[model samples]
Target: MLGIALLAHWLLGPPVVDFSHHSALSPIDMVATAHAEVKKPLTVNWQTLRELDYTTGKATPTVLNLLGTDTAVRVPGFMVPLDDSADAVTEFLLIPYAIACVHVPPPPPNQMIHVKMAGEKRQKVAWDPVWVQGRLQIVEMASPYGEAAYILTAVLVEPYTD
Candidate 1:
């Protein structure tokens, strides 16, 4: 049954499964694990954060004057539909606001979450909150939407409260 389900998920996509009953790990627990993984500090120059304007399609790169050694932070974000298919998740971008994509494009690349699932539950499209564990690599990369943007490479996407 598990194999069949996984095969179906791969072929048909993720949304076919229901996760309302799924259990997720807490943010604190995930952080503890991430702390153990962290060997050195990663910093992002606030002034270097690039601001993109979709309306005009203009990009402005400036230096940020802020006080902090840790240039990256992992925060909880809701998953929004990136593709038309119910099962397909084209990309996972972190939003600062409850209605982030609608109001804003996205945070700097340092804030992006590139999640890597751990186990079986991780493979499934979890409606439950999952921790986006990764480092904040504020660099430019080609985006499906066009123009490389700031993003984080999520190491482990854990479960969390919605």
Candidate 2:
């Protein structure tokens, strides 16, 4: 009887594990779970942004990958207010250096980012560095300060800690 049971088990390729106790997630729940999994934003730097060749208008594979995705990113830089408000601004240019596009000539388009606050959100202009978190789009924007190769739809703007 044991030999017969072993033969039958081998032929049947083992019994399937039962998972019926757990309820299947609905489509909406699955989507919510996926979004939650990707909620953490990616920290990006000037070096990664500089991978795009402004002169040739060619982006490296790494830069191209970020173009149209819903990927959230956090970039640390200095803000040059595009709006007239002195205290707060809805739009600004984020640069790698503080003095850039001010005393010195503007950096290449790839080095600058035109950041637009989401909805009616206004960020106070910070003389010190800041971290801008948002969805980054590769779109050319011409500003009074300089031309930016990328545009960031800012979700949050905070003072740089380190």
Candidate 3:
């Protein structure tokens, strides 16, 4: 059943998101907002992040525009814990799909985000999906599980809702 679900998700692509209800900021708009130094958190999807080219270790113009900017963003994904703790989790990789880095091969670097809880903040590892809100930085991070092209210093971690 899990295999079938994975196959279906792969074939169908990411679930449809109503951007109109959110910031209505598309990938292009995200770059513009980044340049404008917008402080409001924008909703970012994995599809937009997947546009990054990790092979050359260089970010595209759009992704590059986001670097060093105070562009707060909210991204929803499953947590792949990096710490050994059974309860609290301070660092983890956030992947678009569940079982991405485990049961199957890890996704591309751009598809995974290295999430670090802000300051001394810590949250319990969530088996279900969660939304990580933070300032997104284009930094290369390596973990025992996989490499990530982006690092998010998360300020808030909450369960994902429709």
Candidate 3 lDDT tens digits, 1-162 = 333333344436543653323555676774465445445566788888887888877666666545555567889999999989959889999999997898546788999999999999888999999999988887889998789999999999999997
Model 3's TM-score against the true structure: 0.72
Candidate 3: misplaced stretches above 4 Å? 1-38
lDDT of 3 at 79: 92
Residues 1-162, model 1: lDDT tens digits: 443443345436664654323425355654454454343223333233334443343445332211123433444655543345456343555433345445445554443333322332223344544555445543455444333344554445556544
Q: In order, what lDDT does every prediction score?
A: 0.42, 0.82, 0.79
Off by over 4 Å in 2: 1-37
Candidate 1 segments exceeding 4 Å error = 1-73, 81-85, 88-90, 103-129, 141-149
Q: Top TM-score: which candidate number?
A: 2
Worst 10 residues of 3 by lDDT: 1-10
Q: What's the C-alpha lDDT at position 21 in model 3?
A: 39
Ranking by TM-score: 2, 3, 1
Clashes of each: 14, 0, 0
What TM-score do all the candidates reach, one by one? 0.37, 0.75, 0.72
Better of 2 and 3 by TM-score: 2
